[model samples]
Target: MATATFHQSIVSFASPSSTISQCGFKIDSSLSFTSKKINFCKIKAMASVSYNNTLLSPSKTIPDNTLKKPNEAALILIRHGESLWNEKNLFTGCVDVPLTEKGVEEAIEAGKRISNIPVDVIFTSSLIRAQMTAMLAMIQHRRKKVPIILHDESEQAKTWSQVFSDETKNQSIPVIPAWQLNERMYGELQGLNKQETAERYGKQQVHEWRRSYDIPPPKGESLEMCAERAVAYFQDNIEPKLAAGKNVMIAAHGNSLRSIIMYLDKLTCQEVISLELSTGIPLLYIFKEGKFMKRGSPVGPTEAGVYAYTKRLAQYRQKLEEDSEVICS
Candidate 1:
């Protein structure tokens, strides 16, 4: 394997940029020197000091232009990049397929698109393709936080991987893999080529099987049935985190993501049938006050110059950029 070298630097308060002046020498960033490398680096601010004693604490005052909002959370949903079955135009529902090399690149690009967003937790399906997408995208995160899978199946596993230090826990993102997030099981059509199936069964029949929300194909789970489990799992496992003001990133399959999107956007069955999500594109939503507000898709810096960031997202991005520039300078 080829190796790359990275340089990490800390930004002092005396830097030219005044935005990070109050942070002391807390800002951090890194740059790598290599041919085949992601040229991005994550900058993190050091922990702030707080006094516990009332007598010793300074007068509590809110910043004049602070953009931080309480009880507001971010949700980023991404369908896994193209799988081998996808390349072959096969019915890949519930099948364990790995990503193609192109898929790998797509995943990385997807990560870069949302790299500035903070991700507190990650969720993915048990299938390797979704799992791979999650891991690869995280590699490009601007936070530089390591993502560790939580294998709490057994007491031994949980105990062995447990973190002993609070600081270490703060620097890592927990990954949870669940089968409930898996793709709709295609049943008898699992390994069949989509074109061949359509030809054999007639396009109308195939269309009904593929696009009809309530119809299941030959012992398979319909999109409605799939949504029942997928949405429930999301509500039970993922919703509470957002409710608690934590940003979450879910790397899941096409149908599963579509189902979740349907719920978030309040899309009608007829409307959802026409919705098509491209491989590796991310959809963002701001969850606040028990409601989800769609932030649409983030257009990466290259393609659109500016992401259609909500007020909150724009502030968040600006804060990170100032901190990053300080550290890199």
Candidate 2:
């Protein structure tokens, strides 16, 4: 009878949900338990034990190709070769100006310098000065076969064309224009000569208007505003291409390019205001992991000719200031 009862208990335990109560057995101190029945209970208890254990482990890592090396991607920021307004020291604002004769030559030289490097993409402003410089540079670099993509708000019908006409060509170069990269709007100051403006307003006031970050000139955008717009566009559009190992170049105006550089270099408003970008010179930037690693200029620290000309202009301004001081005295 005892053996049979033990066997029944074992069978009950083997069934699903194998509850201890369902085994139809109870321990009593008054009654002496058989050794076999006791052994069966031990085995069943061992089988019913639940071990609650869990482990936390780190997730698999994704390789960051963008962070691998600075040489993986680059950005070349070139101010549009000199324009007619540039020579006259006039406020160009958003005005479309053609490049001067010397400006065209400068663009060709810039092309020669970067011809060896494989430029995967090019970006320029909608203005003619910038567009022409980009066109001239690409042609000189023997990459004119690449399609030029114009970014006019009105022109929405064009489809993406092949970078090169030759199907056999492996090289792919895309030239795109963006309005966000346009020159700073000079507002009421547009078309006025810098010297004449200084004479009309005080020299210190003109300097502050030109160099201050937050102070906008009569309905015009300030340097800080330019930086905000330019950086936003760069983060949304340009940064991804750069991360993907594309060598990008931007042909734009002085102020627009300056806005970009200020962001890339992490410069303060004051530092950005002090920066002076010469016409037609290419400023190269190396980026890694979405950060600026290094920057270089195709031309030396300063173009001697342009520097001398700027110094002469400064002297002319000083002379006017001295005359004003005497009158005030």
Candidate 3:
């Protein structure tokens, strides 16, 4: 084995082939460094992920390429970046809102984290914030394929938007927007300042409406009511794609995503009540053999767990690394 150590090293990796029109960098843009600026005799050791290839239990890991089966695919769930209403501390249920500047940056950063991972299709709520988050995140993907929305409202819309060339179709990804994935409706509370509403309605009442599993705000959808539509759409529309070995990414609202996650993890009603998700952070899962296994989130491509445990993922990373070297050269 070649012995190499990097007290500090810098390198950049890019992959154009994986993207449409050969416009992509399969590696994080931050990885680029001037080779002349650093020296390495050899690369001796690499950090191993726990349970994981390193035989350490730092993190619960996928066992021995348990995801090597062709049926296995990656499922990623991300809450939409912060919206304008979020910045204002207002209740933003199904109302269509846009992302704030910080929200846009969050989405871009999120894209960098999963740049190396494969994403064949995307799903987002019908709201503009969720769709914007999805589009912004894809802009950072090492795979630079355009994510075009599928128009299913009318048959003519679909027919009119169809790509005639198979190659163009192959290079593009379909983004499906579903109203079922929208945030839990806040009814009369929409646009109301959360703090003011809490003050007026009493903190306890607001808490029940927000955190209680089945309680609803005046004419609004409760967590349970939201889940009824969200989870049903997931099981009906999303799971089938996973079964077909397609990598799927979903950009949605907090409550809707929480509901979908609750279904995936089989959480109890009480348990789901306590679940909370931060905006713009992605949670990963492996879908195989009609089962879903949470993989936690990958913070970056350099993270050991990102490429370890799954042989196929490791191989994909290896290929990306090779392509990256060629790019830097």
TM-score of each: 0.72, 0.66, 0.73
Whole-structure CA lDDT of model 3? 0.66
Candidate 2, residue 45: Cα displacement in angstroms equals 59
lDDT for each residue of candidate 2 in 1-329, tens digit (9 for 90 to 100): 22122112111110000001111112231012211121212322232231001001211333232322432566777877778887778877677778889889878877766554446678887687888888787776644445356444444434443234566343445677776677766656777877788899988987887777666666566665555556656766776666666677889877777777655544445445666666676766665443454334534323333113244334433443343222100
Off by over 4 Å in 1: 1-68, 301-329
In model 3, the runs with Cα more than 4 Å from the true position are 1-68, 307-329
Residue 26, model 2, lDDT: 25
lDDT of each: 0.65, 0.57, 0.66
| Model 3 per-residue lDDT at 166 | 89
Give a tens-digit lDDT track for model 1, residues 183-257: 777667877888888899999998887777767777666677666667777867887677666689999887777
C-alpha RMSD (angstroms) for model 2: 32.8
Candidate 3 per-residue lDDT, tens place, 209-320, comes to: 8877767777566777677677767866887676666788999988888778766654546555666776787777887555566655678844667544565434433443
Specify the poorest-scoring 10-residue window by lDDT in model 1.
1-10
What's the C-alpha lDDT at position 166 in model 1? 91
Q: Is 1 or 2 the stronger prediction by TM-score?
A: 1
